[model samples]
Target: MKIKCSKILQYGALEIVAIYFSLLMVMSLLTGNLVYRRSQSLLAAAIIVVLTSHLYSDRRKYFITWGALGTLLASVLYIYYNLNDSSQVYLAIKYLSFSLNESCLIILTVSMLWQRTKKFILVLLLILALIIPIVFWGYYLSMDAWFASDTLLAVMQTNLGESKEYLSDYFTVSGMAAIIFIVIVAGIVWRNMQSVLLVKEKKHFTAFISLALLVSATACYKTRDNLILNTGWKAKENLQKYADFQKMQAQRKSIVRLNLQENGKQQGVFVLVIGESQSKDHMSAYGYDKKTTPWLGEAFKQDNFIKFTNAYSCHTHTIPVLTYALTAKNQYNELQLENAVSLLEVAEAAGYETAWLSNQIKYSAWDTPITVIASEANQQDWINHNIGETTVSNAYDLKLLDSLKSLKLTDKMLIVIHLMGNHGSYRERYPRDFAVFSDMSSEVGSYDNSILYNDYVVSKIYEYVRSLPEFNCMIYFADHADAVEEKLGHDASKFVWPMTHIPMYIGFSERFRQKDAAMVNILRNSQDKVFTNDLIFNIMLGLMNIKIPDIYEQENDITSTYYNSDIQRFKTLYGQRFVREDLQ
Candidate 1:
């Protein structure tokens, strides 16, 4: 019944190899990485064969029996904990599962190699353990780099330079400390094992040594692929193709010039407000239960404000939507803006002083095409004047008004105001006073509060415009609608109509009303079901009283009755595409 030291070493080696193999399989399964799974399986099988051979030769029952039992229990616990979905600790357990599985492999490897040529194998495993963590950290760094810059910087508190500095500092200190600790522990274990091992025990240690080599090899391979993908060399090539497509399409379209028939006939001002992340379902003006849009509702009841019932954003995200909306295109697939121009550029060409005021952060604007147009037109101005405790509060729509007041409003000018409306986490977007409904405790309630704050901000802007004598006309619509209900813990991936549905409003001054009553009624009664974003170029042409180009004449005009039916059929066929191309 007595155990030989050599037999004990063999049994321990087999147990360790089995535990390591199990952990590798579990890690691969949990991470859902096919590459890792295939590589680990190859290495795990090699380790298992070497260890099992030694186990069969060993006579001692105690070491092999107890070690096998312990391995089984650990593997079972790992699988069970991960499978339970209802538990609150599920996410925490999932995050730590990979690390825990790796630790189990480490423990098994070290224990099995404790008796034969123990000094050498112990030292190797220790150094290898340190390398394993460094490799994992490198993978994390690579994945972070793969994501877009806007996404990465959005979560960080510091500016770009400071954020990079922080990440670099964290990696250097943590990596060095972990490597040093592993080396010191290995040295101690190796020295102690040297004093205790017999010469006869040396052959049995080969099994454990092979297991250490297998793990090190797999980690290095995975880390190498991770680094390559993160460099984004391929993504840049794809972007170039998209840009080329846009440029080529623009060149194909013909340009038509407009001339003023009579100078100083009747000067007018127009303010176009572009809102972000607003849903029509949350607005009281759209018949929602919450009084989020009380002021807008009252304003609509008066004959001044005209509301469009079925406006929708072309895309879900800002970059794609704005690119298409401003360029007179739908998505990046088709380029229609060859000789075409943005409404702002058109207005400027018509001898109007144009200005673009925005509450969005300066960097976000700089990253997009809208800012490029703003810069080219020399009408750039940001309204992020407040720098308070909360970053979100500093850039609300009200700050845009502050910037607007400083500008000189001429009789013939066009002002574009871009508002940051109802972007989430909804609670952070609004003030505490906007929390009107007492029963609203969930994410939906927070969204309601955000909508209320946006309504208040819109009312404030409308009041400012109404008080100004030079400002005669104002047009307001959301840049895109949001997934308000889905954002409140529901499925957000399912694209719904309400997610894209937006509200459009137009207000005319007394002077404009009296002078252009016939034209005003034409716009008001127009039953056009045209895509809202695509109407930008044509509407601008109509407002300026310019002759329509060959391209424009071919497309549906919002001012005509025939235009309405054609747009509906177009919408039914190509959806947004017909509007983007035919209309442009």
Candidate 2:
């Protein structure tokens, strides 16, 4: 059967566009993550196919066969990208765009290579068939999570014995079935190609090659900043990142000198209590109608204890917010996370012994930047032994206090306590005795009860430290809050006021407050200022009175006299949306 050039162009271009949109629309509806911008990219790709349709004028059979195959390959890759669980909608769409671009590049490269030499045709078929096993593994991973750079990094860290065990666990009956299916499909495709032998007959050169280049250029242009989401690209990128992290780890050994100018305390027990999913709106000390924070309410009466009413979290998630909060990276800064200096490193540099105590899990299957930072501390204790986001534990925040008590005392100390306060499964967060709002069976009631329990835990920590002879300073802050009204946690996609409006407080011993009266007064006055958690790194330094001139921006330090509160324009989610707009 013979097909006209006009018919080929009309059907080929139209079919490609139709299939692209149909896959995108179905995946978008299923995942509920893709945004409108992805559709624009897909449209651009379809337009490139239409404009470059004349390239196939000379070789109709070759064009039709390769075009159909490329579309199928692209669709499979698109579905694989959407399988990721934690990726943002914008990022998911970007990954989908990369899949489209990758498929186009594969078609262009393979066609050109086969046209030049017929010997590697069978080899190409084998390589193409290998995609089935790769996709099957991806599908298996998506049942729990999806492939990421961290996944590759985890595999690299594992021993040979562990790797063998891990592979055997996933090599199920279905996996074997997929392998068999791909072998049959590859045989059929190879036989069809052998029957046609179209590459031997292709004689036209200039027009086809010109169109191919234009199509490749279009694909590259549309794939800006999205990057490839496949395992191979991610592994290469993560290897570079891991290398950079190793450099940062090496940099942590040397002592960094700071000219405090006779202003900060270098010898005392400084306690930083990091709360979880705790919103100021639900706390009595922050003017909630309920007595969710009764202990804090009483503590507010004392001159040493002060609460920052307008403080917020930089981001609406645990990892990103804490990553910035515990480092020099701020919402306004252009500093890369890998290059940023963590609080533990700074404390160690200042000649203070640092301890990290957490009620959260110690390890994740993927890369845990928090765990990396936490491990840098001189002493570390993690109460929860569960793995990553997949598992949940009932380890109470009080366990952190027990861990803190077990640590050996040092003269100059920095103790960081990470509490599991009010993180999802709110009912499970508190003890039976602390379920004060049990009579009221609403989600808000459960959340308030968790806050009540957290209040007790914070007060107990304060009580324990106050009993100590060494001058003590305690600062309590949450990573981010929850939006109970919408039944959503701190999801970046669903931005809300409660997610950022976290609870924050600082208390000093009488002796220390008398000595550092100037710093205490500055902090007291800045209580009402619009403070974000990202600026906490500088403030912690200020509390310790360790002044690294280059690293510490006084404008970002709440304890500094020059602290700026004019950052009403500061935004979250990498400055995509203004946080002030969500502030009620």
The prediction achieving the highest lDDT against the true structure is 2
| TM-score of each prediction | 0.56, 0.67
**Which residue pairs in candidate 1 collide?**
250-338
Q: What is the lDDT of candidate 2?
A: 0.68
lDDT of 2 by residue, 88-132 (tens): 555445545555554445445554565566747746654663473
For residues 1-584, what per-residue lDDT tens digits would candidate 1 score against the true structure? 35687776776676567655655555445544322323443344334333433422332332333233223322332332343332323222222332333333444444455654556666566565444334333323332221222222222322443234334423455445644654565455444433332223556556655554465344333333221223233334434433453454323322323432333444677788888778888888898988878888898887766777756666555554565565545432244433445555555656678888877555542343555556544465776543222235465567777887887778787788888676555666677788876696666787778788888887888888878887677878776676666542111122445556678778888777767677678767852354455455555555555443442431444554444434434331115333334345
lDDT against the true structure, per candidate, is 0.53, 0.68
Worst 10 residues of 2 by lDDT: 192-201
Clashes of 2: 1
| Candidate 1 C-alpha error for residue 57, in Å | 22
Q: Which regions of candidate 1 deviate over 4 angstroms?
A: 1-266, 331-340, 364-366, 385-395, 488-494, 527-530, 546-557, 560-584
